[model samples]
Target: MTANPLADDITQAAACLGGDGLLAGEVQGFAARPQQQEMAAAVEQALTDASTLIVEAGTGTGKTYAYLVPALLSGKKIIISTGTRHLQDQLFHRDLPTVRSALGVPLKAALLKGRANYLCHQRLHMTRSEGRLGDRRQANQLEQVFDWSGRTASGDIAELSNIPEDAFIWPRVTSTTENCLGSECDWFSDCHVMKARREAQDADLVVINHHLLCADMALKEEGFGELLPGAEAFIIDEAHQLPETASRFFGMALSSRQLLELAQDAINEYVGETGELDGLPDVARELEKATREFRLEMGQGEQRAPWSRLDGNPALTEAREALKTALADLAIQLEPLSERSRGLDNCYQRALRVQTLLAQTTEQPPADYIHWFETWRQSFRINLTPLDVSENFNSQRHALPDCWVFTSATLSVNDSFSHFAHKLGLEDATTLQLDSPFDYANNALFYVPKGMPEPSSPDYTRHMLDETEAIIEAARGRTFVLFTSYRAMNLARERLRDSCQFPLLVQGDAPRNELLERFRELGNAVLLGTSSFWEGVDVRGEALSCVIIDKLPFASPGDPVWQARIDAMKEGGGNPFMDEQLPHAVITLKQGVGRLIRDMNDRGVLVICDPRLLGKRYGRVFLNSLPDMGRTRDLDDVVKFFHASDALSL
Candidate 1:
């Protein structure tokens, strides 16, 4: 095989794999899709050329290999960053190994997760001695972990999935930088995180999540030494999420649930009953009740009413004061409990967090910070976040000067990268977009249901649900009804549950992966979900033939983080909607639409039940962001499109 000279010279040092490399495919049997080959060439050029690269390789472009081959062959110590832990694992375990074997080289690679994944020996010892395992299930899991610790080489909690990820027991086992005893710990000499870092430092390629990458960019002394390690480049997969994740890391947030958890944990440690807080449960219950009452009083009868400030209602004022006093009393009780139980450290820490949150909520925040209260289900929450992430992003970029490459299936809007570029402070960076190999017009129909009201109208939700039901019926059970809000998702799920012939799957019914597994397994299933499902879902083939998006995903104006950002933009004389919200929605809509076509042969219908896409001028921006599917309004046409593709496939 003739290697492209534009490819890295390290390709000459290739070593063939001796085994199957743990995947079903052959090690040397990899074939690059045309777009992937082009992207790989471009990335190779970017390294040689020392240019910042931004490429959008839509789904099935095989982007991971396109960048990985160049990165591995570059002989450059490179960091491959992803948006989620799942992707991080996929690259490290599946993709990297396959690529390395195909290249026929002894290239070294390391998968570094966040600090939270590594076991904290000190915490583990403390919690074990204190018998703070909480539940019987956790105790059993801990017993297995203890046994596994002796024989396991890498102390990654991910290695043990039998234990639920949300099991609080992991916190007892894992160590954060805050809680790590560092050099003083008994496990310091054998620290798994340190070992991983050392391996990463010596390896040709390092795989990491964006959170860890951003932590290295933001925090001074994070365990993972400098992010790039004087590497030739950094390739960020799932790059569309970079801006939002960056915003989160660059900003600050303190939630009440965190505080309440802390208080309850402290009580658990003191009472030696690790189930729930002893005397404090009643107090916590009353606090929740009071908070709900306050919200009700403030909202009157309007469920969707927004709160501008915290000073209007006398009842709200009284509730706030009472809640604060109760929490303070709870905090004092927790202090003693925390002192008695080192296992209660997280609990005590959370209590202090709650106290700080309460204090912050009552005070006047800086102009840079946006503060707001959210009422959900039976609880209320106060939030504070930064107004603009551009400044912070710019600072980070200037601080770290390695060649940064951001790639995703949906980063650009209508061939323009302006929205994403601005958000990521990519003013001086190189940008490229690689269209998916999938034939969208041939395989997919863009169904903009006609005569629907604007999304802003009160009747929009019901109308959108009705339209979605029609499309689902036409597609005959292979559908994804994606909504922007939980209320809408629930309503649609409830309305269609009895009427729909197929098995209905909702988001919260299980973990995302499990839900997806079931969706694919069921074959004819109607899955209704919200934001998280919009992106990262890969349901190719006949399982997912229809996708219904309720509306263009605009950031809620009442969202505390968004309101702060809008206010900040206003102060700077910029249109917040244009600069921030529209682009965000466009990127998100791209993700939702991209879900439809997974392979060149896969056929589906993307039904936008919201009329705003046609009614409003900004809607074109979203329409243009999607793959060029033939548009249709007639229900018969959509059904015809699906059946036509199915026939062609047969």
Candidate 2:
């Protein structure tokens, strides 16, 4: 194939860095894969052509540099949106610096995270003075934070991983839009969030997470200015997650914990002790009691009842009213303290949201969305999300005439982009599918066990677990058994725990990256996980030689949102299973299968325990979606394939 002009430019750019001159300058001289070159071309073209572009560059593609290079070279203000905060930091701190240094480009780049990551000095001082440190544990955490703050130049909370993300101390230490005193605060001039924004405003490249990007798209903050002002282009990596993230930004949600936090914060302002709310623990106890009574009175016999049933309960009505009155009383008591403590502003705002949520839930909701209540051990949550995110995303895209680029490794089915394109409302957008340079034929085997029950069968989970155990034995424990449901994952974990000869690690055992680190360190550990593990996991060489998918990841029809979407599609003369569900499953399955081959010599076995793939008519669609692995039913062949390859080397 003739090299495109942008590709030629990238080639010359790589040549400037010396070495093999094939864009091989990786982070610390790690060789750049050929797929990275292809991705770089697509990104460069998207910039030059000024049109929407979608490309799927698989694992081991080194796609970070691919897009980063063109973005820096174009010298245009660009917003590079990532799926996670981890990647956002990596791109800004590590990848961007290396690429800019190697390519001899002196482009300024800034990393901006969501509002919650930055410390709110206004809230911090208020919390400290109000005696809101609560307990010795919190006080110690605060002391450590205070010491860290003095030394911290960036004021990014992520710098302190010792503190859990969900720590109660964070809400007290961090600033929110509602609670931020702005110029009134002593630290406003030195605010980390504002500093990051200022840097983003001046830089040619800005890195942000999807949530922040979507928030900017949906909320349109004025004082802080647009996130991508002066930006001519946008690149969203891990693009599959955009639809869900956009939906969350567009929708509304309220949880009991949020309400309680508000009540506690307000109470702290009034009582001058954070633990003073603890003295009123009876209030929480009463709330839980009333919630349970309300649920029982509502005829929600089972733990999981349709949200529609929430309105029928008179007890719920009474409970909600009682909660509202309590919150309002708390808010009234804190009104005077808001002047003294900026933290009280957040409490007041939260109370207002709770009151509003109660009102909205009582009223008839919009037909486009589904309202639901999720009951947990100690709390209840009310959620309202659009049944389909496509419409909202479509509206947003139409509103902006700016060029867009969405890329992921698994955006297509059998080389067709119709599913993802339709879902994202990009029907007319240009699309490309860059095949991974890894040779799957030599590197992997697709193992579909014979005579397994259909995925829908009652015994399917048990059978799948049994078969998975056998394969794990053969592979000698370098495995990732991915399940579609938590139920199956639990069952598999229970049944295989003692039987398996290797050390077993499940998803919940630790955070994903930590688990991966352990798994790689052990070298032959078996890790079992669900949806998150299906994609965005990079275990390139050893430590992962077998990937067993429980079944095709079809959205459960019984799921409230999925059911609503299916009905909506049916009304529009669309086959939800084919147009919506199948392609989604294809992309998901592609992600699971793509985990196997991360390098040219990397080898593994992809075993789909679900017989439906071979038995059902739609199976070919999923099969075709995968790379050309030598399909087989024999267990022995998979063992032979693994033994023959160098992937098993210690």
Which candidate number has the best lDDT? 2
Q: Give the per-residue lDDT of model 1 (tens digit) for 1-650.
A: 11124334322212111123211145444433667767777787777676788888888788887787777777777888898988899889998887777666688788888878877666666577767556898888888888878877888888887777888788778865545556755578998888888888877888888888777776734558665555667889999888777766664444444444444344444555455544756655555555555556555432332245555667777877776777676666566666544455545565566667677765565566556556555445555555566788777766665677789998887678888887877767677677788888777788888888877788888888777777777787889989899988888877888888889999999988899999999999999999999988899889999888888889788765677678778888999887788888888888888888887678888888877788889888887777777888899998787678667768
- Model 2 gets an lDDT of 0.75
Please give the lDDT score at residue 326 for candidate 2.
Answer: 66
TM-score of each candidate structure, all chains considered together = 0.82, 0.90
User: TM-score of the candidate numbered 2?
Assistant: 0.90
- Please provide, for model 2 over 1-650, each residue's C-alpha lDDT reduced to its tens digit, 9 standing for 90 to 100: 11223355554333433346424554454665666766777777778777788888876676787787777777777888999998888888988888887677888888888778987666677677767566898998887777787888788999988877778799888876655656666788988878878888888888888898777777635123565546788899999888878877777776665665555555555455344545334443444444455444444323343477677667777776766666566556555555665555656666666668766765677778877666755556677777777777877766664678888888878778777787778887877677777777777888998878877789989888878888888888999999898888999889888788899999988788889999889988999999989887878677898999998888777776677678888999999888878887888888888777777667889999887788889999988778876889998887787677644564
Please give the RMSD of candidate 1 to the true structure. 5.9
Clashing pairs in 1: 14-104, 14-105, 15-104, 15-105, 16-104, 262-347
lDDT score at residue 136, model 1, on the 0-100 scale? 94
Q: State which candidate has the highest TM-score.
A: 2
